[model samples]
Every structure is written in C-alpha cells, then in structure tokens.
Target: MAKILMITGDFVEDYENMVPFQALLAMGHEVDAVCPGKRKNETIATCIHDFEGQQTYTEKRGHNFTLNANFDDVAASDYDALYLPGGRAPEYLRLDSKVLAIVKAFMASNKPVAAICHGAQLLTAANVIEGKKVSAYPACAPEVRLAGAEYVELQMDEAITDGKLVTAPAWPAHPAMLKHLVALL
Candidate 1:
C-alpha cells in the first residue's frame, strides 16, 4: 500500500479533505493528515464550499477534521505521495516556510503530488509548477500562469495529470484525481 501525506488547515474544503482521505483508506493506502502547529488528534475546523448558482461558491461550517500525524515530525522522504486539498486554508498555508519546504521536497523527488482547487496556491508558492500543465480553480488561473505553468481549464469533474503532478479544478474531480494518483503510485 502507498503511504500518503495530506496537508490541510482550518477552513479546508470539507469534501476535498474527507472524500479523498476515506477513499484512499478504502483503497488500502495509509494517509496521515497533518497541519502546521497541530498534533495528532487535534482537529481543524472545516467548511463546505458548494455552488448554488451564485457568482461564486457558498461556504458553510463543516465537521471538524482530526489530524492523525504531527507536522513537525513529518519527513517528506517517508511518504510515497503528497495530497493538498483546497480551501481558504491554502491562502495561509502557502506562506509557511515549513509547508513550502515539504512541498518542494516531494516535487524534487518526482513523487506523486495531487492538488485540487485553491490547493494550487501551495504549488505556486513552492515554485514547483513552472512549465507544468496544471488545472486549478478558475480564480487561480492567473497565479498558476504567473508561476510559469500552463493552466488548462477543464470541467469541474475532470483532472489533468502532468508527470507526477495531478490537479483538478475542485472536489468534483476527486475520482479522476485519485485515479491518476493511484496510477502514479
């Protein structure tokens, strides 16, 4: 089974975090979710982001997500792949030196890295998406391009895999994202 590391924080998209976590487990893979300054058993507040015909998505409070690992103790080399779930959390997580370093380490090793929605912010911050074809939340297109990456706009339910990196526009693309990640693993 592949060992995966997932990084998340407060206000992480509820579905983006839970669905993949459970799906990976059901597939016999081990996933350890961690957040900066958070320890095992600690919980991060989550929020649901759904489209309701509005110009943008609506947000609602979601169940608290529990961390199963400690971020300070994580060594990128110990995991087979990395997962980044998008939400408001990525806005701040991208500013963390530790988080950026972990992301860089994974990409540097050419390990499978999966990201969705705003999660692409971290990839841009880590400076690892340059020259790669990526698909992310529409709002992220500019930054993705500025990062030297070719942003491909796809349907919400689709995903784009470029080398070891897998990205999608949102949670609706979970199935495709997971499939690509599993293949890479």
Candidate 2:
C-alpha cells in the first residue's frame, strides 16, 4: 500500500478533507494528516461549503478533525503521494514557505498529487503547475492559468489527471478524483 501525506489546515472543506482521508485508509493506504504548527493528535476546525443556488458556495461550521502527524517531522521524500484538500485553508497555507517547499518537493519529483477545489492555490504558490492541465473550483481557474497550467474546466463531479497530478473542481468529484489518485499510487 502507498504511504500518503495529506497536508491540510484549519477551515479545510469538511467533505474534501474527511472523505479522502477515510477513503484512502479504507483502501489500505497509510495516510498522515498534518497541519503547520500543529502536533500529533491536535485538532483543526473544518467548514462546510454548500452551493445553494447562490452565486457561490456558502460556508458553515463542520467537524473538528484531528491531526495524526507533526508538520515539523514531515519529509516530502518519505511519502509516496501527496493530497491537498481545498477550502479557505489553502488561502493561508499557500503563504507558508515550508508548506510550499513540501509541495515543490512532491511536484518536482513527479510524485502523485491530488488537489481539489482551492488546493490548487498551493500548487500555484509553489510554482509547480507549469504546463500541466489542472482543474479547481471555477473561481480558481484564473490562478491556475496564471501559474502556467492550462486550467481545464471540469464539471462539478468530474476530475482530470495530467501526468502525476490529479485535480478536480470540488468535493463532488471525490469518486473520480480518488480513483485517479489511487490508480497513480
């Protein structure tokens, strides 16, 4: 089974973070969920984003997810794959130099990476999506393009894998995204 590293932080999308973590574990893969400046067993708050006929998604309080690893101890080289679940979390996570370094390590090595929703922000910040066909929430397309990736617009429930990177628009694409991600693994 592949050893996966899930990098996430507070306000990460509820379904985006929890679903993949459990699904990957159910597939017999080992996943270490970590957050910057957090210790093992510490928890972070999650939020729900629902598209209820509004111009954009709406947010609500979700679960309090626990971190199973220490960010300071994470070595990108030690993991076989990387998972980046999106939400408001990526907004700030992309600003962390260490987090960006880890992302760069995985991308530069061509290790499989699955990023959904706003998670692509980190990839753009890491400057690792150049020439790739990546997808994210509709609102993120501009950034994805600015990062040099051809932003492939996908349906809400669809996912696209370009080389070792698998990307999707939102949590609705979990089934396809996970399938592609696990296949790469």
Candidate 3:
C-alpha cells in the first residue's frame, strides 16, 4: 500500500471528495488527510454543505478532514503521492508560500499529484501546470491557460493524466480520478 497524503480545503465537497478516501482505505493504503489547522472538537474539518434544498455546516464531513499540521510540517520526501481536494481552501492555500513550495517539491520529485476542481488553482500559483493538459472548474480556464497549460472541458468522472500529475474537473469526477490514483498507488 502506498502512503498517500491528501491536502484538503476549508469547504471541500463532502461526498464527492470522500470517494477517493474510502477507496484508498479499502485498498489498505495509508491515507493521511491534512488541512491548515485543527478544528475544535471535530475529527474532520467542517464546511458548509449545499444540497439544493439543504445547506448548512456539516461537521465530520469531507471538508472536516483533519491534517497533522500546516504545510510547514510536511516534507515532500515523506509521501508517495499528494491529493488536493477542491473548495475555498485552495483560494487561500494557493497564496501560501509554504504550500506552493510543497507543490513545487512534489512536482520536482516527480511524485504523483492529483488535483481536482478549484484545487487545480493551487497548481496555477505554483507555476507547475505549464506545458500540461489540465481540467478544472470553468472559471479557472483562463488562469490555467495563463499558467501555460492547455485547458480541456470534461466531466469529473474522466481522468486526465500528464506525466505524474492527475487532474479532474470537479466533485462528480472523483470516481474516475480516484480509480486512476489508486492504481498509481
């Protein structure tokens, strides 16, 4: 089993993001869910869940996935792969120098890095998406292109791999993304 480290955002997709976690666990891979900080009394970081008629803060949800520490505590040498779950967290994480450093380290090390939805935004900031084909939320098309990546509009269920990097559009694409990632593990 591969040691997989996942970086989560503050408002991650509750169910969609959980698919890969569940799959990795079932495959006996050691998965570490990391975030910016500890959330009080919550095993996972809590986030607002919007399901049409239902929307509220859901504790112990996907967004609530706890981390061992901030980006500083992690070293790129420690894991075989990295997964970034999309949400508002990427907006802030993308700007963090430490996080960008980690992302660069992963890319330079040729570690398998998987990013979805807005999480791809972090890659843009790291300047690691250049000359690659990537997919993300529609709003980020120009941003990805500006980073020198070719943007493709596709469903989340499809997996797009470029060298050791994997990307998907959004939550709905978790299945295929997770499947490809797990296989890499």
Can you give the TM-score per candidate against the true fold?
0.99, 0.99, 0.83
Residue-wise lDDT of candidate 1 within 46-165, one digit each (tens)? 999999999999999999999999999999999999999998999999999999999999999999999999999999999999999999999999999999999999999999999999
Model 2, 1-185: lDDT tens per residue? 99999999999999999999999999999999999989999999999999999999999999999999999999999999999999999999999999999999999899999999999999999999999999999999999999999999999999999999999999999999999999999
* Tens digits of per-residue lDDT for model 3, 1-185: 78887776566766545767777778898777766554323355445433354342223444455444445467778889988877667888787787888889999999899988788898999999899999886768899999999998887457788888888877778778887777676
Residue 105 miss distance in model 1 (angstroms): 0.4
lDDT for position 119 in model 1 = 98
lDDT of 1 at 36: 99
- Model 2 poorest 10 in a row by lDDT: 146-155
Q: Provide the lDDT at 102 for model 3.
A: 83
Per model, state how many residue pairs clash: 0, 0, 6
Candidate 1 TM-score, C-alpha based: 0.99
lDDT (Cα atoms) of all candidates against the true structure = 0.97, 0.97, 0.75
lDDT (0-100) at residue 163 of candidate 1?
Answer: 96
After TM-score superposition, the amount by which residue 113's alpha carbon in candidate 2 deviates from its true location, in angstroms, is: 0.4
- Model 1: lDDT of residue 169: 99
RMSD of each: 0.5, 0.5, 4.0
